[model samples]
Target: MTVVEVLFLLLGLVAAGSALLVVTTRTMVHAALWLVVTLGAVAGIFLLLAAEFVAWVQILIYVGAVVVLLLFALMLTKAPTGPQPDLDARRALPAVAVAGLVLAVLGTTVVAGFHGVELDLDGAVVGSAQTTGATIFQQWVLPFEVLSVLLLAALVGAIVLSRGTGRRGGE
Candidate 1:
């Protein structure tokens, strides 16, 4: 087994474990923290695939900004910070079975698709930053602007929701 394979295996395990924690944790804050870990591990996986720009963006956008905002909202709302109830083994068993089936199908599809493909790691890593920046601004500027607007809307919504309803027009 190669070093890359080992890294991938370890990172994948971390990502999966954190993702499960995110869903299973009772406390909202702990779930958000687990989500951050999962997002960071995904960023590491992107870096291992020689996608530094994407990895940094994942960390900056998802782990840094989104999760922070989510936590802030949770705090503002005074969400319950208690231990979770026990997982229903009956529901969990079916859910796990479905998840496993989906994973198997996706894995089979990816492996079959890339069975004969050869990727050049050096080329993938070289000059990627400049090209990625240019591509994002040039090709995806519209979507980028739209996402900014969406974020602004989300922030406004959070603020509006946090405000109490007992407000007067002239106070």
Candidate 2:
């Protein structure tokens, strides 16, 4: 109906289509790239919703850090650059069913919760960087630190797995 609604719908379609490609693509690198696109579309949606902080975080954390990490890992591990031959399509039906069910439930909940409700964006400061930073530092510091440590550990693990005992020249 409105321009914002039209833009939101377009972004939603992009996000959904890229997400589907992320899961269905046979190439690992392509899948990771598609995931980046999906995340970027989600960030666009957040920007449309007037959540600037969240949009930038989504771009920085997901599209920048996570996807780059994934691509780095793929390269480090010498993963196949082309389409995989062993990709299984047997689970597609079940996966689609589950995805449809989840989407239906979430759609129902959102419609019921916000039925005919209009958001007043004027003077709203909830998604500002100051507010988000304070909330993260004050309330989510420990979990955030723990997650950082976990990601570091995973990166180290991937490197270790790729290197494999460090023996060279038949030593």
Candidate 3:
């Protein structure tokens, strides 16, 4: 097989495996770590698909910022530094059913959409760093600003919640 195909298969497996671990792992911290893996694999897949802008954003926003925030929250809340409680199969069954339904629908839609469509990306430009930066700054500036504002708000909210014990003195 071609190099691209091999890379795609590897990244796809990593994404899928980490996604499964994210759901299956009992420890919240382990789940977050697995989610980081999943997000990084997704970024790799985006890079392979020639969407460098999306790939970088995936790395910067999800793996870098979001996961860091998650870890911070875990630390602030003093989540068990050890393994989490075992999964309850009864409670998880419903979620599993819903996930299966959604996955089936998505799979059907993708298969139908790509039934006859063949991609020919031989001429498309795999965007450069400068060009991608210019496009985001010039065209997608509003969304970037919005994302930054949202992140700022989340940070402030987490700090507020963590500090609000509501006890003025020793009780």
Candidate 4:
């Protein structure tokens, strides 16, 4: 394999490992931090694929903005810092089953969708900014909107929790 292939494989492994940690961690803060690592690894993989703009977008949008917002929400909510029994329990059997099911579905979809299509990585990308921007927005609109809603939900939850504490303390 080539050097780029090796780097890509390494980054994929890192991303996968951190993603597992993100789901399994008991602490909210640790999970958010692991999510940052996972997203950074994904951005590195994009860089290896010669998608510089996409990689930077991933870093700036996911690693910089989303994770920071998640961390802020966690802090504002004053979530429990101790080990969560519900999160830590039975991590092996159920987690493996769900992960396997997801992998099977995604793998089958990718194979069916791109059965004979070949990716030509050797060609230089020469698209204008408008074209690239439009493509990104078109393809990523769902995910971007979903994340926006999720972040907004977290912010609202934080506000609710903080108010509860304030009223309890008679502030």
Candidate 5:
């Protein structure tokens, strides 16, 4: 096939593998780090699709903010640094079955939707920053503001949780 197709396949493999690791890893910190890999792979796929704005946003929002937040929360909560023995392989079969089922559904839907269809990339500017920004501000402003508020609240909650109620020496 084409080089782009090969690259897309590679990125998809990376994303899928990392996503599996994110779910299976016993260490919380390692899982978060694996999530970063998964997100970075997705961003790379976005870039390969010529969606520059989406790629950058994926990197910034997911890899930068979300993963960092997860790591911070893990650290603040004093989570275990080693492999958790409690997390056994008992759910592996069920998890794999569910994943396979979802993948089958998605693949079927995609094939049906795009059957015999070809994309015309000429003069297409859907992924441009200007277009994305205008759409977000014009039609998605309320949701954007609500998400910002939610993030702010989560940040505050993390800080509060990290700082325990016990008084310090100065107090």
Candidate 6:
């Protein structure tokens, strides 16, 4: 197809591979790092799709804040950073089967729904900041504010819990 399609496919592959790594990696820290890679790849895909606002938001919110929050929580908790045998031994077959089934159904639905529809990228409006801001502020104000408050609460709670634990494991 076009160059953009090729780049989109490549980015999609990168995102999918790293997302699998995020789940399958034995170490918690490594998983978080892989998630960063996956999110970055997704942002690249959004950029290629000409959604500049969304791409930057993905980079800022997910890659910057969420991943940093996860990493901070992991470090502060002193959780195992290495592979754990008991965790490794948990049954994965059922999960894999379920994931495969879901993928198959979704893929089929997408193909069926979009079989003949062609996108007109040349005629589409560029995703502008003013439009996006207006749309969000007008339609999604409550949800957006609620999400912000939730993230703030999570950050506060993590800090408070970390501060409360003493040297004797809070005994």
Q: Best candidate per TM-score, number?
A: 3
Which residue pairs come into collision in candidate 5?
none
- Rank by lDDT (best first): 2, 5, 3, 6, 1, 4
Off by over 4 Å in 1: 86-90, 116-118, 126-129, 146-171
- Where is the poorest 10-residue window by lDDT in model 2? 162-171
Give all TM-scores, in the order shown: 0.73, 0.74, 0.80, 0.66, 0.74, 0.79
lDDT of 4 by residue, 97-127 (tens): 9979999999999999999996666765734
Mark the regions of model 4 whose C-alpha exceeds 4 Å error after superposition.
88-96, 109-118, 126-171
Q: What local lDDT score does residue 51 receive in model 4, on the 0 to 100 scale?
A: 74
Backbone Cα, N, C clashes tallied per candidate: 0, 0, 0, 0, 0, 0
lDDT, candidate 3, 1-171, per-residue tens: 678789989999999999999988888889889999999999998988888888998899999999998998888888886776764475887998999999999999999989889655566778768878898899999999999999899989978777758763684
Question: Per-residue alpha-carbon lDDT of model 6 for 16-132, expressed as tens digits?
Answer: 999998888878899899999999999998777668899899999999999998999899889697786565547889999999999999999999999999865665666667778
CA RMSD (A), model 5: 3.9
Q: How many clashing pairs does model 6 include?
A: 0
User: Which runs in model 2 stand beyond 4 Å of their true positions?
Assistant: 137-171
Which 10-residue span in candidate 3 carries the lowest summed lDDT?
81-90
lDDT of 2 by residue, 36-149 (tens): 989999999898888999999889999889899899989988999989977757657998899899999999999999999997655666577988899989999999999999
lDDT, model 6:
0.87
Better of 1 and 6 by TM-score: 6
Please give the CA lDDT of all the candidate structures: 0.85, 0.89, 0.88, 0.84, 0.88, 0.87
Clashing pairs in 2: none
Q: For candidate 2, what is the TM-score? A: 0.74
Clashing pairs in 3: none
Q: Comparing 2 and 4 by lDDT, which wins?
A: 2
